[model samples]
Target: MPIEVKNELGKIQVMNEVIATLAGSAALECYGLVGMASRNQFKDGIAELLGRENLRRGVEVRHEKDRTEIDLYIIVSYGTKISVVAQNVQAKVKYVMNEVIGLQVNTVNIFVQGVRVA
Candidate 1:
């Protein structure tokens, strides 16, 4: 189901794919992030890097009860701190979703799929 937003003018519906794309874009802006990874890319302990066009495919958005959650599959640079990168991604995703799209993102779960050399 698409999320509904109400303003003084009218009510608007936003699809989950749109939200996922926005979240994925925000995530890619962070330092040390190589790119997004496919959600189902765990074959033989490897993750496939997704291109810019597959932003929505790399992210999973779940709206349950009164909470909104986003799961980001990512590949980080080999030399960067994994923990720091994940933290930044979480903060950025929430900020962009709330500020740009008017969507309140409650949780951002970052799954480090792989690490690649920059």
Candidate 2:
């Protein structure tokens, strides 16, 4: 379901996929992030890095009542502090969603799927 925003003009709707893509792009701009990881679990499932075109596949967006929650599946660079990377991703996503997109994001959940050496 698309999120509807009410303003003086009328109603504006934003799709969840669009929000996910924006979040993924914002997360990619953060340091120590290698790339996004696919959220699906296949046979012999490993965290496979998703291509730029599949940004929405790596992110899951949930809207409950008036709160929006974003879940990001990511791969971080090896030797980087995992906690710091996660925090940065959280902050960046929140900033882009709330400030840039004018969307109210309640939570950003980061799941480090893997660590890439390069």
Candidate 3:
């Protein structure tokens, strides 16, 4: 007997995972970024199982018909200047997302979550 599989066509919403991964990778590229963690980490065991997801919380993407909005939360090294670090992060992330993902980003919001002593 042959089994038939049903294919469901699903509307793909802008993947939060992809956004997070991009943001995390961009932030890490900066010299001052020490680490990042998502607010979701406190909720479940998600951080332990899916470490990448935890990093993705640093980025929030709101998709619209014409554009996408991105919000980033990050941690910087204690000695780094917050303003400069934030600017670097914004620039890098925007460039990467625009060039690599080819998404029209409407805005990039940067939030400094913490400063890592080390």
Top-lDDT candidate index:
1
Q: Which ten residues in a row have the lowest lDDT in candidate 1?
A: 40-49
Pairs in clash, predicted candidate 1: none
Q: What is the lDDT of candidate 3?
A: 0.69
What TM-score does model 2 achieve against the real structure?
0.94
Put down candidate 3 lDDT per residue, 17-76, tens digits, no spaces: 776688778878898887665644433432222245466766777766666677877777
RMSD of 3: 8.7
Spell out the clash pairs found in candidate 3: none
Off by over 4 Å in 3: 1-14, 40-53
lDDT per residue (tens digit) for residues 9-84 in model 2: 8898999999999999999999999999999853366688899999999999999999999999999999999999
Q: Candidate 3 at 13: error in angstroms?
A: 7.5
TM-score, every prediction: 0.96, 0.94, 0.72
Give the lDDT of residue 114 in candidate 1: 95
Arranged by TM-score with the best first, the candidates are 1, 2, 3
In the range 1-118, model 1's lDDT, one tens digit per residue, is 8998788999989999999999999999999999999997677888989999998889999999889999999999999999999999999999999998788888999999999987
